[model samples]
Target chain A: MRIIAFASGKGGVGKTTIVANLGIALARQGKKVLMVDTDLAMANLSLILGMETSPITLNDVLKGDAGVWDVVYDGPEKVSIMPASLGLQDTQRLDLTKLPGIIKQVAPKYDFVLLDCPAGIGEDTLAAMASSTEVFLVVNPHSLSIADALKTKIAAQRINAKPVGLIINMYAGLKGEIPERDIISMLELPLYGVVPYDEEVRKTFYYKKIQPVILRNPDAEASKAVYVVAGKILGIEIDIKKQGGGFFAWLKRLFSR
Target chain B: MGLFSKLAFKLLGIDDTELPAEQIGYIKDISKEYSVPEILKNTFGEFVDSLLHKHLIEGVVVFKENSLIYSSSPDILELANKLYEMFSSFKRENKVLYFNVGSWVSMFEKDEFVYMIKSDTRLCEFELNAVAKDIAVHGKNIFLEEYRKIMSFVKV
Candidate 1:
């Protein structure tokens, strides 16, 4: 399986959101995708996906009480999520011996393995990187953010992991001045695509239980942008019109088939 | 240089890349965890955290005996490739610069006057901002003469 992880040097840069959306985009392309919440500490991917109380979690798999499939949940767009429990936050750091074996067991089953890593560099973040093949850095267009990203690049090289590219999140077109060139210069990372700041991403978790923003607005700027990146990561050509559908429609078809 | 090579890429100017905030902080934090200099720790942490919060830093790592030991995220690999491209323009001109004057910040003692310079040369960076400053008292020759007159009570 091709494993890709979403990570940031600092917190609150929309790492989890990208993971949730990107996984759906890839899965919608007919690729069996598995989204792993390696951020054992602040296990919040579930909240982003709107499944706060999952039946099982990564802790169960780590503790040997359940298989990886048991903790896996269907995400908004049929993406499989290996969740982390709120109660097992401390287990964020992977136990080396069991990790390779566990990853080996499940890696062959999926086309894409996307890991939602926690914020900051700790034992947990490193372990997540170790399990993946490529890494996607998330950044905001700010000097301080660019500076941290500069340093984060060094950290990645310290370990022999491939730095894939970057995603600019919460992209604000202030007065039509995107500062795209400045950010590109400062962070010195490849510009994959920009995700415009959208209130719908936050609202979907509350009133509507949508699988992903793509299903709601396939043509939305942010959704389209995310799909482009997902397409690049999975190396697949995507036609959004072919994949746009609500959750119930998918459920009905699943039951019928 | 072996230790430097292991970390050369992680630090600013150590390789042909722009150091991400997370990687910078991770290196500093890890270095400090093993008794690295306090100056690097303080400045690096502040700089890295600030960038990270702003989303400038995408990935970071803390190495243990080389290899991809630990990281802020698995995506650090992607950040590295981008950084390689990001700093390529400045790579040829990168250099290790030193300051002759004492630091402008007053938090450090007057006797602790020391030059602040960029240690990383992988990227061509020539600017250094004054992080902090403090005021100090100065006296002229006339003031010294007046002070001597005022010291009449002394056994002259």
Candidate 2:
């Protein structure tokens, strides 16, 4: 029962994207995975997994209105998702301290439990971090992002939830971008993976279905990098599952930037 | 601080690792019916609904000993955590606690609990005293109603 939180000190570093793709990749490797949208306030893991209106969400379980198992929804391959509620009213009267116990109830059944944490270190964010066994900080290649990730790392340590590693997202390899080695040194954590900035990753959200990049176009740079992260976690090599659309697939990725 | 930790902090122009927004944002536990803030809020809300209906008061938050029982806004919830230290002073002489921090605030106690009322305008100290008396008795009814709901609905 390895419960891990994918957190970003600042917003928009592809935290949700990495969690969704990694969950799918792990599931493909014959590992039981459960991805939870712990962000209660602004949830998107459900959207990427193609579950827009999840009738039962983590909100219900926190409020003690529903059982933890009752809210678990099946995702791509063998992955199970406990998505956060989309409704505005779902965030009300939530007792987040009960989260650890709720995760504990269902954690034994799965090999991996991935928490999609909310941005900013508010009460909601703290609750998610406290509920997980370890935290993985996500940052972009820049000074401010690294600075924020450092604060997130310290916060995780104070609560006794060790921040195990770092994942650099949207690496464009442009000038003025902090080198990956510098990011690792400043954050003082091992680098798990680096996801290259890819347009195909954006198409998953822009297109009709709102699927994960790993499923929509496995050959995409962002998808391959995410699989590598998943493979490292699962201790196995992953061969991208290719669904042949060939030239038309290239056309789809090109236009959906 | 390590070599890189100090470098990142210096480069970003921030010295403190603790961000103001990163405080522990919840009551330590919820299964203890006496400690749940929502139940206290709902119970006190019912008692103050008439004043709220008349627009005489903006809102009311209830706190029992240390735990904040209820607050209308999430922003105000953090304020409750800062208030426990001040509550001890109210036990001896300060029958009615008043402060003006943007919103007019008043706190009066009844037994082990304290009720905080927020108003747009400054309220007369004597007048607040009388209202506090009425609430002390009325707070009992609201407690019964909330407790019944919690007993039936909540497991934790």
Candidate 3:
């Protein structure tokens, strides 16, 4: 199995959302994907998947109270998930070192293993990176987020993890936003894909009906972008048609105007 | 006053007649448990809790030896244990571990024991690093004083 970890130097960069949607997208492409919520302390993947409480979580597996296989829940879009415990007290007693072994045990069963890591370069994040074969750094198109992504890249290098590339999210074409080329130059990582800012994504969180954008609204610009990223990862070509009308259609509208 | 008013007073620079009694009581409870100074407890707890609540830093845990002294949230003891091991190894190598991810900064000091400070948002890396250095330089005295206070009340 190809183990890939999605991590961000900073928080609120939509790392978990990417993992959730990308997992679904890959599943749609006939790839068996397992999305593991490795962000133990702030376990939100389960919530994002609309399974706020699971009887068995990664916490149980780490504590030896339950096996990893026992905690695998059937998430939306046929993607398997090993959710983390939501309880605050449960975060304290985890053995993060058990992650690699758990991944090792489950890696052979799936085509892709996507670890949704917590923000920052903390031990939990490092452990997730250490266990994964490749790391994908997620960042927003902002100086602070880009700077943090650079640090995260360095930290990943320190542990000898291969950083696959960068996935720029929340691209709104704002006036002061950093350019994609500059981020690539500074971080020295190839651009995997860019997910545009979409209100549908915000509504997903606001309404608490956490479903993958790809499955919820495939026509959305953000959803199309996510599909492209998933396609790139799987070495498949996803044809996303441009939205605007062709030359003849444009001419007709102009004449009408 | 309510918690929101207190938060507004502190975060939004709003004026209030008095601090929130519930918040103050919560800080006092933490101060009693950790045996740290009330002022320090109140300030650090509020800062850390605000970050966690905002999802800035995933979690923060402080422990001496095997005992957890403080944590920003619950269910993160394993993270603390792993950090302790990693920092302990770094300490053995006569090195400190520091890294900045996004806006978050984490620093580990291996003096008498391992002390870790982690946070993101409202503080840049330079400022957070300065605070970490200060803690490394002078934290032992404060921690020892708190430990002494706690030991005095021990039944054994």
Candidate 4:
């Protein structure tokens, strides 16, 4: 299983939105994706997916009341989430020595496990990096955002976490010509994907947008971009507008039939 | 004196910028070296004479196991002398000096304080937290590569 972690240097930079979208995108491609809400204190991924109260959460699993099968819930777009409770301090104080065993128990069941990590270089982030194989350093195009990201990269290096690439979320339009080149050069990390700051993404949950754009509006420019990224992750070329011919085509037709 | 100075300078690489003109000439004359700069010779001669009679810094013998433990600070000299007396009374082998580096220097032997010197910035690590505390306490060595140059002036 490919364990990819989504992390940001500072909070409120759409880390959850990226995880949610990536989970759906992967699932649409017939990949069994598991989205983990590891933000223990202020868990918000459930709210984003419009799930008021999951029958089981990460707290229950950590407390051993429920297994991974019991806690995983279907999200908006067929993606599954191992939910977490808000204001969970006891679980947050869990002994770090036992985290790897817990991950190993639940990791092998899915094709992709994406962890939504907390902000800052605290123990929680360190634990997440320890459990993850590849780290996605999420950032916006602002100057201070890039500066904070550099500090985050140093912290990641301290634990020897392999950085797969940088995800430039919230791509605001060309106003004064963004300094994208300078940031890429100074950071020395590859640009994985540039998710445009669109209203569809912000309104995805509220408006009941469950299907991946790669499945719905395959001809749209943003959908095409996301499909290309999804294809790269799956090690195959996918034409977003091809309608129904790819690795997941048989499953798509199985559902459509 | 001149031969000793050359040997010391050669071994330590003490540059001309760290020495006065008069001391340079005196050192040159004692070693039968005619290359003494005139001004440096005058300064060295005057400094030595003051050391002999003025009791300015005379009693300070900065040794490892001597009854007399001396320091060069004018402000904290009284407290230092009291501590020295306390140590000397017990026959303890120790002395201490306060440096501009804003740190306390304690020595069991004279050699410890004899080598205390400042560092330059260009040679040391760029990050402030990575720098050695005593070397960076003065805040001048932030420039880099200068700590190595100042090492030559230390009386090893």
Candidate 5:
């Protein structure tokens, strides 16, 4: 089984969203996927998946109260999930050293295991990366974001973690944003895929009806981009027809006229 | 008076009879080679003097390559060595460790280097770990910049 950790240097970069959607996308391709929320301190994967309450969580496993199998919840699209507890006290008593053993126990049951790591290179983030077979860095197009991602790459390299590639999220092609090509060059990592900034993504989070955009709106520009990423991960070429004549495209045509 | 006698009489206000021959011989032997003790004293003395001048630290000790290189207070060397050993073991286990004793907060980096910053100002363990993370991630030059920025805020 291949285990990949989705990590970012800064928060609010859509790391969790990418992991959720990517898991669903991979599951849709007939791959058994396991999505794990390894961000123990601020566990939001459950909230993002509209799973506010779970009978068992990673906290119980870390605290020696429950087994790993007890916390595994069947999420959408045949993706198994292990969500972490939201207790502040649990963060303090967590034994991060046990994370690798925990992942090892369950990794054999799935084709792909995606770990949603916390922001920044803390001990928890290192533990999660150490447990994974490869790491995928998520970053925005801002210079600070790129700088922090470079630091994350360096940290991962120091720990001998294999960095698979870079995922550019929330790309809007806006002014003052760093270009994707430059980000790839500066980070010195291959571009897996770029997910565009879309209004539908905000609506999903705002409404707390967290579902993969690929399944929700397959025609969305962002959804198509995510499918490309998932296809690359699965080593499958999906025939995605380019859909044009959106409002932005129409506005560009009007301006050009 | 002769040159040696004159120098001794002027510096010590004592004749050659008062200065033992062994003591004079020992001084001559020390002057022939570069004195490591003197150099360590002068270098560390200057460092302590500057910190005192700036009122940055009450005492400090430094270790590199598993040896005590410089120290403002000799009494702290034993404790520093112990802490170094502890941090070394932690590094072997792939863990970063930090702690505080009284007014001084100590940070142990992955390169087997330790820094003691004297301040009553409290910083959470997360912030301390973040400092260690930056050093591990960005290398020494960038870590030094971050160290300087932290010192700028904490230095009185």
Candidate 6:
């Protein structure tokens, strides 16, 4: 089982959303995937996975209030999410150091265990890193994001946690944006995949919308990019929904399925 | 210092930007090879590398019966003495003290020894309920490496 922490230095970079979608995508590939919301304070993974009402969350587990199995809820696309409590009070007084031991207890049951680390290098972020075997830095195409990501990568290294690669998410292909190669050179990690900006990512989970963009719109550019990254992780080339323009792309997407 | 040098110190895991320059050098003197006292080496022995590598703990000051025991720097010795003089009335075993502005030094007392551990962040909700008696069990190092860089400037 592979326990990977998805961390980024900055917030509002869609770390939680990508982790949720990736968990679903991996689960669709017949791999038992568990997505743990280690953000603790500002948690939205449970809501994204449509399992926000899970009474026993990772907060309970970390606080010794509940067992690990008790908090594991079945998510959409057969993904198992150890969500964090939405309650503001639940974030307080948690024995976060136990996260490593807790992850060890549940790791044997899943092929991919993705942890959504809280933004910035907080104590909670360190706990999440300590729990995971490796870290995947999620960066956007920009200097600010890359700079923050470098610090996050260094933070991961301090704890002896291996930061595996970079998944450049939310790439808009803007003219002045930092290119993928430069990002790779700066962060010093191999490219996992680049998820282009897709409106479907926001439209699906804006407020009450719970379906992840990957499953809701597999034909979406972002979804297809996620599949390619997932395929790389699985060590196999996946059949992505073909991209083109208008009618031809529609036909390719339909026939490719 | 410039951004590049700051980044370099941060990359070295000895950058504590939280603390000001005078009390502790912004760029901690991690390069200076200081000898570990024979008594401290006997108490902590070979554990320095593990702490330095695995954690970012600034420095571990073990004060025995209000007497300086482990801290190498005389300045920290003065601060530790002031800490005891200032907060002696408080009977709490685990207390977070303001040894320096922007830096939180947590004191864990057991028997007669005071284990003052400097950790980055968590000044408000800072308390290690565990590791009160035994300092070795502190699992949360939190940016103490940067703390140590600032601490290394504490001259004996």
Best by DockQ: 6
**Per-residue lDDT of A178 in model 2:** 71
lDDT per residue for candidate 4 within B12-101, as digits (tens), equals 966543223353334334323221111111342343233322211222222223322223334555545554554445433333222222
lDDT of 1: 0.57
lDDT of 5 by residue, B35-122 (tens): 1111111243453454332322355454445655455667676667777787666653434355566665464444555544333544
TM-score of 3: 0.60
Rank the candidate models, highest TM-score first. Answer: 6, 5, 2, 3, 1, 4
Pairs clashing within candidate 2: B37-B69
Query: Tens-digit lDDT track for model 1 on A114-165?
Result: 8888877655665676567888788876555555555555454434345678
Question: How does residue B82 of candidate 4 score in lDDT?
Answer: 58
Clashes of each: 38, 1, 15, 20, 0, 5
Task: Give the 10-residue window scoring lowest on summed lDDT in candidate 5 chain A.
Answer: A241-250
Q: What's the DockQ for every one of the candidates? A: 0.02, 0.02, 0.02, 0.01, 0.01, 0.06
Residue A249: error of model 2 in Å?
11
**Per-residue error (Å), model 1, residue A218:** 3.0
What tens-digit string does per-residue lDDT give for candidate 5 at A119-192?
Answer: 99887888888889999999987766776777677666645567879999998766556777777766677999
Instruction: Write the residue-wise lDDT of candidate 2 on A1-257 in tens digits.
Output: 79999888898888999999888888777789999999898888999888878888899999989998999998877799999988888899898767877888889999999999998876677777877888999999876676667767655653446688899999976655677876776677889899999998887788777889887887888888988787777666666554324678768866764
Give the whole-model CA lDDT for all candidates, comma-separated. Answer: 0.57, 0.73, 0.71, 0.56, 0.71, 0.71
Question: 1 or 6, which is superior by TM-score?
Answer: 6
TM-scores (chain A) of the candidates: 0.84, 0.92, 0.91, 0.82, 0.91, 0.92
Whose lDDT is greatest here?
2
User: Which candidate should be chosen as best, given TM-score against the real structure?
Assistant: 6
Residue-level lDDT of model 2, residues B44-82, one tens digit each, is 545456435332567666676455665645666655555
Q: What is the interface RMSD of each candidate, in Å?
A: 18.5, 18.3, 17.6, 24.7, 26.9, 13.5
Give me the iRMSD of candidate 2, please. Answer: 18.3
Clashing pairs in 6: B56-B144, B56-B145, B57-B144, B58-B147, B58-B148
- Candidate 1 docking band: incorrect
Per model, the share of native interface contacts recovered reads 0.00, 0.00, 0.00, 0.00, 0.00, 0.04
